[model samples]
Target: MIARQYLERAGLHFYAANVTLRGGELDLIMRDGETWVFVEVRYRRTSLYGDAAASVSYTKQRRLLHSAAIWLTERGGSFDTTDCRFDVLAITGSQLQWLPNAFAAAE
Candidate 1:
């Protein structure tokens, strides 16, 4: 809810779809201008293991990327441009950090 609230407050209308069947989950999906964004919502009070953003490992990124590809292929016409990104919204306590282009090409 906080994430949606933040995105709404930021003036970005979004779609939140649960894609657990594919084993790749997207907390929220939104259109940022002409760009399609697959967002992973994270919450970590402290960085005991690591910051929430930092926790998106290569494996996780690959899964998210795969799921995104599936979504694009299934939706058809939803993605016109090659401009897509994996974003991370890290809410550590009361602070909200948005990481754009959170990862490079999926490995």
Candidate 2:
């Protein structure tokens, strides 16, 4: 809900939510102009270990990239011509932070 509201407030069009591919899942997908924004939502009650954003480790990033590629393939779009970005929405307590292009799509 937080992530969707944030994207809506930013004027981005919502595409899909909780999209599950074979490898992984995308929390939210939105269209930011011509770019497809694949978002990962994370929530942490307390930051004792680390913040919510910090939990999206290297492995998680790779899985997201793979899933995104699968989505494009299934959607029958040319990846070379399409623009895509990975975003992260971190919710800690009452604070919500949207990190655009939080991680690269490379391993």
Candidate 3:
């Protein structure tokens, strides 16, 4: 919710949220101009192990990619034509870091 509000204030148009699929859940979906953005929100009360962004592992990235693909397909969109990106909203305590183009689908 904080991430969504932050992004909205930053001028990203809100599209969807908490999109659950068989692969995984997409925390947020937004549009920056013409580009579709798939966002993952990670919150950590403390960084004892690692930062919130570091918590998104390779497996999680794969799952996000799969889920995004399915979502686009269901909405009659294709990666070949739709400009899309993956983003991460990492929250540590009261700090929020927005990382755009955080990952990409494997070629």
Top lDDT: which candidate number?
3
Per-residue lDDT of model 3, residues 28-104, tens digit only: 99999999999999999889888899999998998999999999899898787689999999998888999999998
What's the best-to-worst order under TM-score? 3, 2, 1
What are the root-mean-square deviations of the candidates from the true structure over C-alphas? 2.3, 1.2, 1.1
lDDT of each: 0.76, 0.88, 0.92
- The superposed Cα distance between candidate 3 and the true structure at residue 33, in angstroms, equals 0.7
Could you tell me every candidate's TM-score relative to the true structure? 0.83, 0.94, 0.95
Q: Model 1, clash count?
A: 0
Model 2 C-alpha lDDT versus the unseen true structure: 0.88
Clashing residue pairs, backbone N/CA/C < 3 A, model 3: none
lDDT of 1 by residue, 50-74 (tens): 7787777778888887788777777
Model 3 TM-score (2 dp): 0.95
Task: Estimate, for each residue in 8-78, the C-alpha lDDT of model 2 and write its tens digit.
Answer: 89888999999999989988999999999999999999788888999999899989988898999888864
Best-first order by lDDT: 3, 2, 1
